[model samples]
Target chain A: MHSDRAPLGLKVAAGLGLAFMHLPILLIFVYAFTTEDKSYQWPPPGLTLKWFAVTWGRPDVWQALWLSVKVASISTVIALVLGTLCAAAVSRTKFFGREVISLLVILPIALPGIITGISLRSAFNLADIPFSFWTIVLGHATFCVVVVYNNAVARFRRVSGSLVEASMDLGANSFQTFRYVILPNISTALLAGGMLAFALSFDEVIVTTFTAGQQQTLPIWMLEELVRPRERPVTNVVAMVVVLVTFLPILGAYYLTRGTDTVAGQGK
Target chain B: MTSAIRFSGVSRHYGDVRAVDNVDLDIAEGEFFAMLGPSGSGKTTSLRLIAGFERPTAGEIRIFGQVAQGIPPYRRNVNTVFQDYALFPHLNVRDNVAYGLMVAGQPKAQRHGAADGALEMVALTGYGDRKPSELSGGQRQRVALARALVNEPKALLLDEPLGALDLKLREQMQEELKSLQRSLGITFIFVTHDQGEALSMADRVAVFNEGRIVQIGAPETIYFRPETPFVADFVGSSNVLPPEFVAQLTGRKAHGALRPEAVHLSEQGHSATVRSVSFLGAATRIGIRIGDVPMTMLLPKSDTFPKVGDTVTVNWAAEDLHVMDRA
Candidate 1:
């Protein structure tokens, strides 16, 4: 049915929108292995895998990649645990200032990231703490928690509270209820949230600018490479890798979340 | 008898509205006790309090000879078959049934064996690998029962467990659950808004209204001698007659309730014109107007039915007339 029928105008509009969104990334991948020049070039160049080897050989690239991975890993782990706890505590209990707590966690993402970065930087300066890896991890985590917390809280609400009561009434304690009941129920949501948090931390640039002292994350390295030495092919190669690494998890997460909603209307 | 479940001066108020008010009750051991009430009558809240899901605002709950205040639900030797069943959607039937034992760290073989036995008891022997979503409503309900029974709780608290089923399935499950309770000989505290289910299945029933226990007795007593007008009206479809109609026999302001079955169409007694007659196969229900109060009388369908506008005498034994103080 899809292949045989569609209005021309609507189909063209949809095609244009998809191309507009993805054409630049496709171009980046195409030119990333080009052998023509130091400048970004189109179809004239021959293809080569040499730029990837060059990128792998650079000590500076490896250092920045390692730093980025370390920060993203730490930030994702911290965000997962803290976000799950916050979601559980807020969802399970009735208390004063619940809306305020919700607002605080969500505010980091809703407000401009620059504002979050500057405020965190100022707070760190006042506390007499030096800018370092931990600070960068902390800064990236501020926004990453918002992603994890929002996802986790939404999933927690979807789980029936009666299930918790049923578990408890059947002689399962609170921790066991969470582990065997609540956790498995929300596992897919948490998995999706964790992937998004890792992607966010891996690519985060603005907050890292304020939080990093001498350390160079991959994004910072890319920024420096773009402005200083015009090593266009090597930068494109790195960008291609970054796009692929981040894209797969996001696609997996989208599929994971989509499965639930597709069958939701059927049952209800 | 030492009470299996006791509530003494128990009360719970959500803000200013009392959900359960200064209630006192003693449910006997091994009895299939039911709390029957309309929605908002605090029956479910009292069950939750006894289950330790909710803390009483005042007084105490004693379960199996132990004070239940501040004790979590997991520590209480009582399980609940929730109104919604609330089966774990992600777990297979076996895992869900074994959840309580697994939580208590029972060994793998013992846990699986116990769960299997419980599943067999509920007639879900071969469906252990399927998730809750895969089961039919009745099967899911049986899984819920099996899950609760596997723990072998001292008592099982059922909060309208059959409320979600279709009528035929509900009837079948009711018989199954009642028989299961008798065979186990464990105390079963059941809650339902359906009076037929309560009266037919309960060994004894507690009638609740407006957050208080209005009456507690055997199913026959609850049906025949409801303590209040509310209980009478709530428990059965009563044809409420004004005091004036029965005043010559009972007294002034003594509200009278006649079970539709108790009133008969006779050639002699108080006369009323038939408004409508419904022949319901097994029985016929005749709606009549006696003065201003609307009255209904049930007669065997084999007996002659009065036609509309036909004047007929509605007669009953004086002892079948129930006099109550409140409506």
Candidate 2:
């Protein structure tokens, strides 16, 4: 697809598409440094690092940040285990209703966020589970599982059945085959899945609202700060931190999976 | 010639598909055996059965006089070199070769040393530090051979191992494999669809068709005295004369197989009109019609040759014509 020259119209269209997606985030980034706290006034705000200092001092913001990190990390770990197991079962075995099982596994992510949020709230109430840090972790794991499953199943299918057979022929038992052949083949996929799950869980909003009771994650805090303004630039500053944390892993995952379409021993 | 592996009435069926049906085989130690067949003829399935990758649905497989049906592939005393060279991507060539040893609890230092020796045997020394992806197809093939041979199992099974290589590389690998088998003196059961590879390299060949063995004999016996029409036509595309033609020539009503090379132009013999003429590099192939019975003959290329529509007389030695079973 690459030619010596790209037409001017195609280049302009690509530039406009990028701007349409990232310009709002750019505005959020600029407002984090704005001196004005009451309103967002374009092209008339002075810049200062004062809101960063204020954000650093607020203990409520610190608690919310700490809680968000804890929920995202645990949810990611849980999703990694459950999702990888689910993918292996569905992709590698034959059973009755296997297709239905796979569809049900991915249903959480495909449904509206509000629907998932409401369902989780009712399920927790029916089970008599307390609405605490665990509740929010539980809510985040729903979609996190979907993210990890999507990555893992694709890699598992591509890992080559011949590789497993080769391992056995080389005198490795099932456990050793899994350890030596299957694990190494799927490690990069698992890593990418984990990163994506973490990023999704970190700034989730609607699900956190229904599930959290007397506990505020970073996104819930930002929502509250928008409704009741106190040093509004502080919220933008926190939003900037959230953006960096999620964006870095997404970038890492992209690079990790790039140019890896072909697996080893896939000779022509 | 002791028995290395034996298959007694083995059958592998999948619902309505009979992949391998009631096959009985005996392979001797220190022999290079080839299973020759078309695709889906149960040849590769039979190899996998010996490797213990696929269990026989019925009957038994014995390895060195031991029952092999209940055992898994890792516990079997045999290994396989897969067609695609399934090398571990994350590992370097050294680690890939040492995989069996590593799984058997051999120390890293000792296994790496053994891996190097195996690589040297395959003429791939000093190439261990690179990954499988870094190596070419031929190089990766050697690594796969080394990986399986390093174990020194009782038997080695190869499933269409040269199917992916180009002409020159395939020919080179074939010679290397034959000589290596001779030096190792281990039983090698090779499966392939190419008759040339089977005839040139194997001590004995088994012809499979439709999930059954159609013929089993030494390669020369198979090439010269093909017992069935399928074997005659498949092995070298020999001219298959119908039973009526045989009745006219030999007073027998059985089908006959006549090698093209045995055909020669003559002065006082059966007259035939040339239908098509093709000039190969070393030989010319002429398709002739003898009273509406079409046959092909091969001859060394010469300036004085009959062209299309030219009527010529053809003859063969009495012993060159062989009676064969119907397909």
Per-prediction TM-score, please?
0.95, 0.93
lDDT of model 2 at position A39:
86
Off by over 4 Å in 2: A1-20, A34-50, A94-98
Q: How high is the lDDT of residue B71 in model 2? A: 94
Q: Give the RMSD in angstroms, all C-alphas superposed, for model 1.
A: 2.4
Candidate that scores best on TM-score = 1
Tens digits of per-residue lDDT for model 2, B1-327: 699989999999988899999999999999999999999999999999988888899989999999997799999999899999898888999999999999999999999999999999999999999988888889998999999999998899998889889999999999999999999999999999999999999999999998999899999999999999999988989988899998899998888999999999987788999999999889999999889778999988788889999999999998999998655
lDDT of 1 by residue, B282-308 (tens): 888889987677888888867466689
Docking class of 2: medium
For residue A135, model 1's alpha carbon misses the true position, in angstroms, by: 1.7
Residue A160 lDDT (model 2):
78
Clashes of 1: 0
Candidate 1 local lDDT, A132-164, one digit each (tens) = 999999999998898899989988888878888
Worst 10 residues of 2 chain A by lDDT: A259-268
Question: Which ranges in model 1 have alpha carbons more than 4 Å from their true place?
Answer: A1-4, A43-46, A262-268, B325-327
